[model samples]
Target: MTTMRQLKKRAQFLKAARGRKIVRRGFVLQAVAHNEDCDLGPALGYTVTKRVGNAPQRNRIKRRLRALSKEFAEKFDPNFNYVLIGRQEALHEPFNELKKNLARALEKIHVERSAASHAIDRKSKS
Candidate 1:
């Protein structure tokens, strides 16, 4: 089984921020396709701002996100990078619900990407 790689650079996170965003009750997901051709698996990053809570709370949120990512590792598109921005609600949200949201978010991102590509194709053909 292929495992997701962790995104460790500030630039990487910033790049993802400029990509597609999907907001959920527990967190916001940002995704973008890889800019260069490489064989590495999908990359993931986690961020929880100070505005969310203290360090402990933020750490907790990140831990939850990591777990969710592992569970959905197989569903991740290897050609894309993803970042999860944790919200305060994540602390109280049920684990099962978070998992469901992550799954839906991943599915939605692909649908949106395809639609966007279709739009670009239509424009170029015109």
Candidate 2:
């Protein structure tokens, strides 16, 4: 399994927000796959904004998201930086369901990425 790193800088999370994203029941997942120049494994950031809840509530939401993200760490692309935005429902959602959602989101991200790459290649060939 590839090593996992925490995304500490605000800029790193902001960068990932510009990438492909998938909305799941418990969270919004955004990912940007890195180029060959980056050799590190997947880096993750978890955030629950003030709009979501108070400090304690937001902290709880972030904790759940962290656990779910860790459980499905291998599902994430090794070369990508990911940000998981916690949702209110995340507090009450079943743990297993959250895991499934994460897996599904990862699969969708890969599909969309591959399609985009293929289109870019075709455009360059023309």
Candidate 3:
């Protein structure tokens, strides 16, 4: 499950950039807040571009992100918006390495911890 809900459309992802914060050392994860049009209230959104690769490659990255995020959802602030942009190697990275990369990305971005996000994730799981 996602702590920050998946962002909906292309326009929504476009509206999300209040400040682009970097978290990890290797990856560049951008956090963009959506407009009110985004009723995410408690969820966040995601966007992966074609630049990443063909359908299969892109899908692999997205799947990895979903699994990685859910495993560490408690660390992310749920109310904030985030869009994961896959780098060229994103598809080929090992799962644990990707999780570490994501954690580092969050750390680099200085994404603050939100108790509510953890609570939300826990609640959702239960």
Candidate 4:
């Protein structure tokens, strides 16, 4: 249920810093992130390369990721733009597992980013 309004665009994706987090089964989840440009809220983006599959396959994976994003948006900080890149194996994964993987990846990102922000705030407060 992730809406288009919550999504970041291609330019933003290219401008973001990125990292990879390994998930269960050694699947690598890639993310490119930028701070939320405005105070409105957190926004997210997704990309499925044709290398992952053909047109239909890419769309299917995009759909799965979108659903997962919507389902877990509450867990994310609304001050950053995030783009998720899907792999070919993602196509074969069951919906539940896909959801779980997405959740795990997002959780790791959230915790890491939150800790980093907290430390920065503490430093600035000193």
Question: Candidate 4 — what's its lDDT?
Answer: 0.65
For TM-score, candidate 1 versus 3, the one ahead is 1
> Which segments of model 3 are wrong by more than 4 Å?
1-4, 23-27, 33-42, 111-126
Q: Report the lDDT tens digits of candidate 2 across residue range 68-98.
A: 8878867778788999999999988999999
Model 1's alpha-carbon lDDT is 0.94
Compared with the true structure, all predictions reach lDDT values of 0.94, 0.88, 0.62, 0.65
Backbone atom clashes (below 3 Å) for every candidate: 0, 0, 15, 2
Candidate 2 lDDT at 123 equals 100
User: Would you estimate the TM-scores of all the predictions?
Assistant: 0.94, 0.91, 0.66, 0.72
Which residue pairs overlap in candidate 4's backbone? 36-79, 42-78
RMSD of each: 1.1, 1.6, 9.0, 3.5
The residue pairs that clash in candidate 2, if any, are none
Task: Quote the positional error of residue 108 for candidate 4 in Å.
Answer: 1.1
Ranking by lDDT: 1, 2, 4, 3
Candidate 1 Cα misplacement greater than 4 A, ranges = none
Q: Write the per-residue lDDT of candidate 4 for residues 1-126, one digit (tens) a residue.
A: 323344546576665435434454413544445454545656666777767778999888788777767787676555556666767777788878877876787788778877988999999999
